[model samples]
Target: MNQTLHAIAPEKGRKNKSTQDDVVYAHIFDAILEQRLAPGTKLNEESLGEIFGVSRTIIRRALSRLGHEQVVVLRPNRGAVVASPTIEEARQIVFARRIVEKAVTELVIDNAEDSQIDKLNQLVLEEQECFSRGDRGAGIRLSGEFHLQMAEMADNPPLLSFQRSLVSQCSLIIAQFESGAKSHCSYDEHFELIDAIKKRDKSKAVRLMMHHLDHVEKKLSLDDDNASDDLKAVFSNVRGKK
Candidate 1:
């Protein structure tokens, strides 16, 4: 445990509480996933301690958890850094997602009720608002939230855990995408998904889910026309200091 992690919660009962650690973990995790903390970005104990108002001990513990989840890396003698996913890693992540998400949608439609469908419809509205406001960060989160919402609908703990991993890896790939824009899976498709779910059309929901993930993959890969260096620079420049 790094000494700095403790300072963030000096109040009595706050320092030992895991709730604070969860907060620190989520804050840093969101920063990395949203591209605010880029690949290879060094998570200096001092800096994170200041940002989250926690001790280095707490930050290290949180980072250790991220590494276990493949979200962050702990380099020997180098402390913690954001995971710099390779091109091959990105491809595998999306491919795995295509399979898992398709099946997850099938499960959702199998078990979901009208009220759950309504909740998802409401979420899509919130997603559109985020996009309209240029809150790509919020929009992307909402885009992914759809899958999580579906997972909750399915109520399969083991599969939900797997989906969580897939979501994290997908976030890494999204962070490396050429532009910091929301995905191109137009909002209408979300409406279609809700309508299909409302109609209890499981196969249609599965098909729509497959197509949605496909669109996500294609958007990430659309820059075959651009120089790899240009795209790499897009990620590298916005990333952390050497």
Candidate 2:
């Protein structure tokens, strides 16, 4: 009786802590995905704790989650920072994405309902609007979301999970290595993908997916260099959202 209550009490406390950690994790992940927190940006634990209004323990847990997902690199003595994938790593990431996203395309075409397709169209519209308004960060995030949502529509939990991490990594990769002013994805290409899915043209959808990935990969050059440790200014928008 007393023993059982004590065990359950500890579990409940852990659950509450985990829930708080998830909120913090999502904010950081979305910030990275949106390119607001640029690659190589230092993520100061104390600053994050103050911004999120949580303890350092909670902030650490959230950063740990991001580290595990490979978007944030955890340093032993230096703490954590946004991961800047090396050029070689960037190549492999795109290669892996091509494989996974092709499968995701096929599955989505087979499983996605018309309503789901419509929802994807709506996402593209929003992405176009964002780009038109010069909100490139928001636009790029929405472009990544379009793919993530397609993975979700594929009806495979494992694939969706893989995409959740891969999309974030790719976004980071683009922010680090992309050349010139090219965008990560074209909204027009996204629309064509939806049309192929709507018509259940698996071959066309897969082809479009591959070509789209190739464009994104080809835009990467080694000329970019970025470094910033202004943690609060980097996360200013994220802090305002809290």
Candidate 3:
């Protein structure tokens, strides 16, 4: 796991226990979102502890938190691995996202300030730039962030928390099912929803949000039965370089 460790290590001299745990969690979380850590990739605590220069306890805490969010599965003897979502769970996740995001967009329209709208617009522009530069991973991560940003604009903590979980799960689903040619969220659709919010058109915003979600869900090839089961092959490139 040397390569993965080198890639994710905290900067020199920044070693606080709590901070290290958060860093470990965020690193794994972002890796999952970017599809760098694929579904079924084993998260061995000892290797992870070595990688991050932390202890098994810190690794356990981070993995436990991910387990709580359903993004990682903690099997007793098997240890933690990236969650491989079932087809049914994928459908349910999309369904929940549609319901929650429709409400989120409406609340954003009602609660967002001018500056917040500007921030959303800026984020889309950055997302577009990521796509244009052929950085698909960053683009995908930014796309997920767009929905989270909308939830934040709503200023509802409970809703924001729920939306965060849904978004994280959707990342796993996308990793599991989406074809390489497919992108996460369409840039134009995001701009259209922002435009509707700018106009404070509740009906239009909700309609566009739902349709946007439908468009995303339709891009996945959910029927594929081939998921990687070889743990060594899955982590080959990312781990044990040095």
| Collision pairs in model 3 | 1-240
**Tens-digit per-residue lDDT, 19-134, candidate 1:** 65666675566556556665776777776665556678887888886776577889999888778777667778888988887777888878998888888897788778878877
Specify the highest-TM-score model's number.
Answer: 2
What residue runs in model 1 are displaced by over 4 Å at the alpha carbon?
Answer: 1-18, 178-183, 221-242
TM-score-wise, the better of 1 and 3 is 3
TM-score of each: 0.78, 0.82, 0.82
C-alpha lDDT score of every prediction, in listed order:
0.67, 0.77, 0.74
Q: How many Å off is the CA of 60 in candidate 2?
A: 1.0
Which of the two, 1 or 2, has more lDDT? 2
Q: Residue 112 of model 3: what lDDT?
A: 93
The residue ranges of model 3 lying beyond 4 angstroms of the native Cα positions read 1-18, 180-185, 222-242
- What is the full ranking by TM-score, best candidate first? 2, 3, 1
Q: lDDT of candidate 3?
A: 0.74
Judging by lDDT, tell me the better candidate of 2 and 3: 2
The best candidate in terms of lDDT: 2
Winner of 1 and 3 under lDDT: 3
Measured over all alpha carbons after superposition, the RMSD of each candidate to the real structure, in angstroms, is: 7.9, 8.1, 5.4
